[model samples]
Target: GTKTISYGCVGGDFNEVLHAWEKEGGVPRSQRCLDNFKEAFEYCELGDLGFAGDAFMWRNNSHTAEKYIKERLDHVVATQGWCARFPAYRVVNGDPRHSDHRPIIIDTAGAAAVRRN
Candidate 1:
């Protein structure tokens, strides 16, 4: 499956889902949503593409640690076949600019795909 898939997943404050997994701070608890989220990914056959740059991709724009919240919300994922195309698929999470959510860049800049039939 030499297919490739790339998408910018946008959901309503998905950070809550991650926090639920961590059992930490963020939005209110919602085990139902969390469970469904896990099932959804399993159903869709999607997984973490691993990432580079700042581990934290977003911040709540708060100076106080007590109120400040940072999370890796932005990400990239693909099927096993797609990942095989670029063995070195790297995700560079750029620093936040004029927005709370930072930019996401998939870096295959040095990937040299093998020619096969």
Candidate 2:
């Protein structure tokens, strides 16, 4: 099980898996794809760092609001072990690259610790 040696944060244009509906609590997610994602994560023992910033990272980029529907496709996922080592990771917002999706930066450096007297 743990013998499988895999490394690296696999990411990029996933083009799917929108959490808008989940965030809104309108309806349950489609079981098919959700199941697949879960299975993959479990197989890899990945930790969902949770999404940050605007609910929707990508949109249709159309003039009409309806056509400009947004969704969270781009993400920063890390292996269970990886997160334990670097808990300060964050998704930094960047200029849109002439596309509907906004560029994201994964800062592995954990946030600075705060001390109170």
Highest lDDT scorer: 2
List residue ranges in candidate 1 displaced over 4 A. Answer: 1-32, 109-117
My TM-score estimates for the predictions, one after another, are 0.65, 0.70
Point to the candidate with the largest TM-score: 2
Prediction 1 TM-score vs. true: 0.65
lDDT of each: 0.59, 0.60
Task: For candidate 1, write residues 17-70 as lDDT tens digits.
Answer: 443433324554577876776676655666667666776666776777677676
Q: How would you encode candidate 2's per-residue C-alpha lDDT over 1-117 as one tens digit per residue?
A: 455635446556665563435322224457787678667766776655665566566766467644445566666667766676666666665567687777777777636432211
Which residue pairs clash within candidate 1? none
Evaluate residue 60 in candidate 2 and report its C-alpha lDDT on the 0 to 100 scale: 64
Evaluated at residue 84, the lDDT of candidate 1 is: 69
